[model samples]
Target: MPNTSRRTSKRDLTLVAVLVVAAIGLITYLVVSPPGGDDGAAQQPAGPSGPSASQSEGSAGADESPLSGLARRDEGDPTALGPVDAPVTMVMYSDYRCPFCAKFSRDIEPELIDRYVDSGQLRIEWRDFPIFGEQSEMAARAGRAAAEQGRFWEYNRAIYEDSPERGHPDLTREVLLDYAHEVGMPDMETFTADLDDPSLDEPVREDLRQGSSIGVSSTPTFVINGEPILGAQPLDTFVEVIEGAAGQQ
Candidate 1:
């Protein structure tokens, strides 16, 4: 395992506590609120590293709809895959520039898709939670633009597959356009236009806001069926969570 910094360790602890508290708060809200109430609220393709199972062991239970407002169950959502009513929904908050997010995309996501999404067991939703500063924000916008053209996933994979294993790289307009072209976005003019359009930026910003509200301070944070799972944990961890959630449904 890579040596964790004190800051990271502290953040992990805080995240776990936040998740537990959020879980408890959710339970209270559900128990008291009226029924049928209306609620308001990746990456490349890096290699696997060490275990992150120890990072988040929160009390967040999958049995409750803790993330119902954020699950984006709309059948027409372009950034989501699998059936809208899939038994389990995996909401991934990630940055385009985060290497760990890339690793998760490259190493583990494909298997999850094959085993869960393709089989009508899971739906994966992408949230643009860029936190690495300007370039990160730009990348998020570019991703949203691609998503406008129905090429979000492909553009995201291109970004990660082209990324280095460490450090932040400059994701200038030239490079982002290159990625868009590489993804075979049929209408380059529309794609570029969308990237330049300010209106295309709101979903990414909303994602960041929603993620922050749930205490996500890092890229690649995931909430699977309302159960918080941190980092690019081993595939087995995902298997356990997905199967458990699916079984419950």
Candidate 2:
């Protein structure tokens, strides 16, 4: 293919670097073997279309359990950030105004976090990709603001949890301020000022461009240990990715 893309920004390069490192870590972990079956990690299905009836039935019992779709296993690996020691790392590039992003954050991420991250087995890195114009820009800025006050993840969580109606107010400064208050992030003035900085803005743009360059055309796109998984897929899908990567090691 011809190289038709324009100039790449430093932030975009940085986001690509993050994805590359994450991919290497995950693939490296895959050369090993897992100790036992994890109810949290979903196995790959039999056929192309989807899981066979029998497979679904087999997974039914595991699904009912609390840890049904959570990745199980922690070995205290270094170079981890979010949920330390996670055997599988899932990096997400998302837009706060995206409905799918909201869905993944409120629904899918919890089980993943509780089982993988909190247990020191998984690290979830979030890249805010702004694609919907001004509101998206607002949301991205707000995320950086939250980061400034050490409440990035919490503030990130709240936006998705309190998703707004389409065409309604979203990513507003006041709404973000409200979220900051709820999450205990003070120093709004400082954060707002910081948002104007190019260094702060580039990561989001880079994720947006880099994700597209890598065929991530939508929000909530994930890089699991270096593999790209699109949309707010089911937990079982994530489990399969993790286990597959782990088994390769």
Candidate 3:
């Protein structure tokens, strides 16, 4: 058999770059396009149905690219916080077993939440893009189950705190249940039931599909207002991108 894994890895890196270039094109188009459907707006191509024509039209040639498709805003997602119409939407793709992802959870994300999410300038939507095999998938399901009880973020913090900084921990059902308990999930019965529900698998899988569509091979890749910031990038990078995105609003 051929080395499909290696080939896919190579493809992911190239696709990630597309996000950066696409962002530049998107930003420029936003600057050039007239905002309130003025006469110039008539010239812009009608974008794909998923994202608004205003945002996706800039990504014209890359019609099928994930960046345009992935920014759904998902207004009523139970696991998401902040206003759906917040000026900037940050879509985060993370693997529960990835250390850098844990670092982002522990380190940068809290600051972002306080500085932006609290101010109603940013809305963050989480996507579980587990790439570390079964254990990672299990953890993602556990998170989704926790969201049923309004404890997704709590469960996330507790599990990442307990997890090692590097390496995929064995996230068996027992461990997942323990983390649920640790996060003060009110009813273990409901939590466990949700965890095991086969129906929950599809949402987690859909998250993975969306992440892959956008070329996310690594953990903690963030698309802030359609601009990609990969890995556990420095706080300043986030600040600059977010401020710039916010400025456009």
lDDT of 1 by residue, 56-79 (tens): 122123434444434656667888
C-alpha TM-scores of all predictions: 0.75, 0.62, 0.75
**What residue runs in model 1 are displaced by over 4 Å at the alpha carbon?**
1-65
Candidate 3, 15-115: lDDT as tens digits? 45644654555445445543333423222222331356655465444322234335655556776768878888888888888777888888898999999
In model 1, state the lDDT of residue 169: 65
For candidate 3, the 10 contiguous residues with the lowest summed lDDT are 40-49
Model 2: residues >4 Å from true position, as ranges?
Answer: 1-86, 164-169
Candidate 2 lDDT score at position 36: 28
The worst-scoring run of ten residues by lDDT in candidate 2 lies at 65-74
Ranking by TM-score: 1, 3, 2
**Predicted structure 3: lDDT:** 0.73
Which residue pairs show backbone clashes in model 3? none
Q: Kindly provide the TM-score of model 2 when superposed on the true structure, using C-alpha atoms.
A: 0.62
Winner on lDDT (2 vs 3): 3
Per-candidate alpha-carbon RMSD to the true structure: 10.0, 14.6, 8.0
Clashes of each: 2, 15, 0
